[model samples]
Target: MAGKQVMLVGVDDSERSFYALQWTLDHFFHSPSASPFKLVVVHAKSIPISAISLGGPGAVDILSLVEKDLKSTAERVTEKTKEACKKKGVEVEVDVTEGDARNVMCDAVEKHHASVLVLGSHGYGVFKRAVLGSVSDYCSHHAHCSVMIVKKPMAKN
Candidate 1:
């Protein structure tokens, strides 16, 4: 069988996401004879300023600024991931989309023909997660392909 066609890694510039990316690269891409896989690191963002200020006098200008900032952040994140991939000798494609993280990730899975989705567990406590809705939780339940959640270890003394 052909190796997994693609693997999508969701990143938010968080430490957990970084660890997840590293773990995925080490476990899958580093292996000899591993299925030739395409790696994609995605940073999904939503700028409310752009969405909510459409009718104001300077709305267009403000929206443009918001988009510029969002794109800049995404580019920075992609660059960081790209550098890491280079250090590990893994080749990957990067994507930055403006939308809900869960939706963006799921869409990328389908758009990129990914066979797996990898993400970091935010490790929010039960109460907080219930109130805020964790992205990993949403992806785990909704993603079309196999999903892996890389969890950060609890701090120790």
Candidate 2:
């Protein structure tokens, strides 16, 4: 990609994600050779499950509480992302949307015309990934742009 292409990184409240973001910044943005990509950080704030119901009078209250918590977590993630970018002296565009991570990221790539979509991998095994559905996997296949999955290094014993 050339002429100030857009590079998007999908982040969550996970260390693996932050590590990937930092790595991208260090390798590409913080390098002496200025990258031609404009960075965009995206966080998918999950919508509260309407299907989750206690079937009691307090069910509404419980749902409201859950929504509030989700909102707070989204805010925290955004703030942390901002701090990370600031520390690197890199300006970025941050977008927070509500939906499944895979869809949100794919949509973001299209929305920004991102040349590359970077995501941190959870490294789930075959069975686990099949059960939980890996966001990175889905994005790699479904996204309109190039997808980069950053795997976290295993800790040395």
- Candidate No. with top lDDT: 2
Residue 135 of model 1, lDDT score: 90
TM-score of 1: 0.84
What TM-score does each of the candidates earn?
A: 0.84, 0.94
Please estimate how well model 1 matches the true structure, expressed as its whole-model Cα lDDT. Answer: 0.85
* Best model per TM-score: 2
Give per-residue lDDT, candidate 2, residue 78.
93
Model 1 per-residue lDDT tens digits across residues 17-101: 9999988888887852464677888889766664554896887777788778777878888888999899877778888887899
lDDT for position 153 in model 2: 91
